[model samples]
Target: MDHVNISVANNEEKGANVDFDYSQRAQWLRAAVLGANDGLVSVASLMMGVGAVKQDVKAMFLIGFAGLVAGACSMAIGEFVSVYSQLDIEVAQMKRDHITNHDQELAEKENLPSPFQAALASALAFSLGAIVPLLAAMFIDSYKVRLAVILAAVSIALVVFGAVGAVLGGSSRVKSCVRVLVGGWLAMAITFGLTKLIGSSGLQM
Candidate 1:
C-alpha cells in the first residue's frame, strides 16, 4: 500500500508541467529564412550588376523580374524535394521501428513532418523578399536613385530578416542582423564591381 502511494505521488509530480518544443518550428523557420535571404541577395545582386553595366530602366527591371520568378520557383522546388526526402526517410524509420520493436510510445512521440507546409513557406518567403528590390527599382525613374534605393532597401531587409531569424531560432539578434547585412553588402559589392569592370573592358552584353 505504501509503495503504491509513493508511485502515485511520483506520477503526479511528473505530470505537473509540460515542455513545448519549438525545434520543429525552428526547422521550417530556417527554411523560410534561407529562401528569403537568397531571394533578397540574389535579385539585389543581379540588379546591381545590370545597373552597373547599363543604366537602362527597362533592362534593369526585366532582369530583376526574371530573377525573382526564377528564384521563387527554384526555392519552392528545392525545398519540396529536400524536405520530402527527409520526410520519406523519417516515415521509413518510423515504420521500421514499429515493425521491429513494436514501439507505440515512440511512434506517438514522433511528430509527423510537413514537407508541403515547409515548401510553401519557403516559396512565399522568397517571393515576398524579392518584391523589395523590385519595388525599389520600379517606382524610381532615375538610374542612380534606383540603384541607391535598392541597396538601401536590401540593407534594411537583411537586418530585418536577420532579426526575425534570430528571434525564431532563439539566438543573438544584433549578431544575426549584422551578419546578414554585411553578407548582403558584400554580395552586392562583388556583383557590381565585376559587372562594372567587364562593361568597362568593352564587353557587350
Candidate 2:
C-alpha cells in the first residue's frame, strides 16, 4: 500500500511539472508570434509607403533597412523594460511572502523572467520578420515587379506566421491566417494609398 501511494504521488508531481513547462512554452510562443507579426506588418507597410512615393530601388532598400534596425531596437528596449518591471513585481511578491529558505528563494528567482533573454528574443524575432520584404525586393529591378514581389512575400510570411501561431495556440488555422493576412493587406494598402495621395500633392522628399 505504501509503495503504491508513493508511486501515485510521484506521478502526480511529474504531471504537474509537465503542465507548468507546457504553459511556459505556450507563453513564449505567443510572445514570439506577436513580435514577429508586428515587425512584418510595420516594416512592410513602411516599404510600401516609400515605394508609393518613390520607385527608386535604393530608396526602398534604405527605408526597409532603417525600419528593421529601428524596429528591432525599439522592440528590444520595450521588452527589456517591460520584463524587468514584471521581474521586480515578482521579486517584491516573494519578499512579501517571506520566503525564508535560501534554496527556495533561489529556485523561484531561477524561474523568474530574464529581461536580457526577453530583449534578445524580441529583437531577433523582429529582425527575422523584417527581412522578408527586404529580401523580396533585393534583386528585382523593375519598380512594379519589386512592389508586387514585396507584397507577395509579405503576404506569404503573414500566412505562415499565423498558421504557426494557430497551431501552437490550438486555435482555428483558417481564421488565424485570414485575420493576419487581411490585417497585413490593410496596413500596406493604407500606407501606400496615403503616401501616394500625399505625394501627388507635390510634397517634396
Candidate 3:
C-alpha cells in the first residue's frame, strides 16, 4: 500500500507532514515522582503524628518505615488508577468525537480534514499535573511536622493543586478543588485515625 502523508496545519493551506513519537514514558515518570512524593509526605506525617504522642525514637523510626512502604504503594496504585482513568476518558472522548465526525465526514469527506487531537492533549496535561505534587514532595522536608497544622497545610496545597488542574483541563475549579482536597483529607484522616488505633495496639504488642 502506498502511503500518502497529509498535513493538519493551523493555516488554511496544506503543509508538510511531521512525524511524532508516542510513548508510555510520561506515565511512568509521573508515577515514580508521585510515589516518592507520597512516601515523603505520608511517612513524614506519620512520624510527626506519632512523635507528638510519644518521644520514643525507636517507635518513631518503626512508624516512619511502615508509613514509607504503605504510602509508596498507595501512591503507586492511586497514580495508576488516576492516570488510567484519565487515559480512558481521553479515549472515550476521542472515540465519541470520531463517531460523531464519521457521519459528518461521509457527507463532506473532503471538508472534514483535521483528525481528533484531544487525547494527546489530555494525556500531556495529566502527566504534568502528576509531576507537580511529586516536585513538592521532593522539596518539602517531611520529617519536621508533629501537629494537625501540618495536615491542614498539605490539605490546602492539594486543594490549590486540584484547582490548578481543573483550570488547566477546562473544568470547574471549585468543584475540582473540593473533590481533590476532600479526597486528600479523607486519606489523611483515615491514616491519622489508623495511626491512633494501631499505635495503641503496637504499645500493647
C-alpha root-mean-square deviation, each candidate: 4.6, 2.7, 11.8
- Clashing pairs for predicted structure model 2, backbone only: none
Better of 1 and 3 by TM-score: 1
* Candidate 3 per-residue lDDT over residues 72-185, each given as its tens digit: 445545555665676567667656676566665465433221222222333333333333333333334344432444455566666666665555455699997787667666
Q: Which digits, one per residue and each the tens of the lDDT, describe model 2 over residues 1-205?
A: 9999999999999999877866777646755887899889989999999999999988998999999999999998998999899999999999899999999988998889888888888888889899999999878889999999999999999999999988877689999999999999999999999999999999999
Query: Candidate 3: which stretches are off by over 4 Å?
Result: 1-145, 202-205
Worst 10 residues of 3 by lDDT: 14-23
In angstroms, what RMSD does candidate 2 have relative to the true structure?
2.7
TM-score for each predicted model, relative to the true structure: 0.85, 0.89, 0.41
TM value for model 2: 0.89
Error of 2 at 136 (Å): 0.2
lDDT of 1: 0.86
Q: Residue 132's C-alpha lDDT in candidate 1?
A: 91
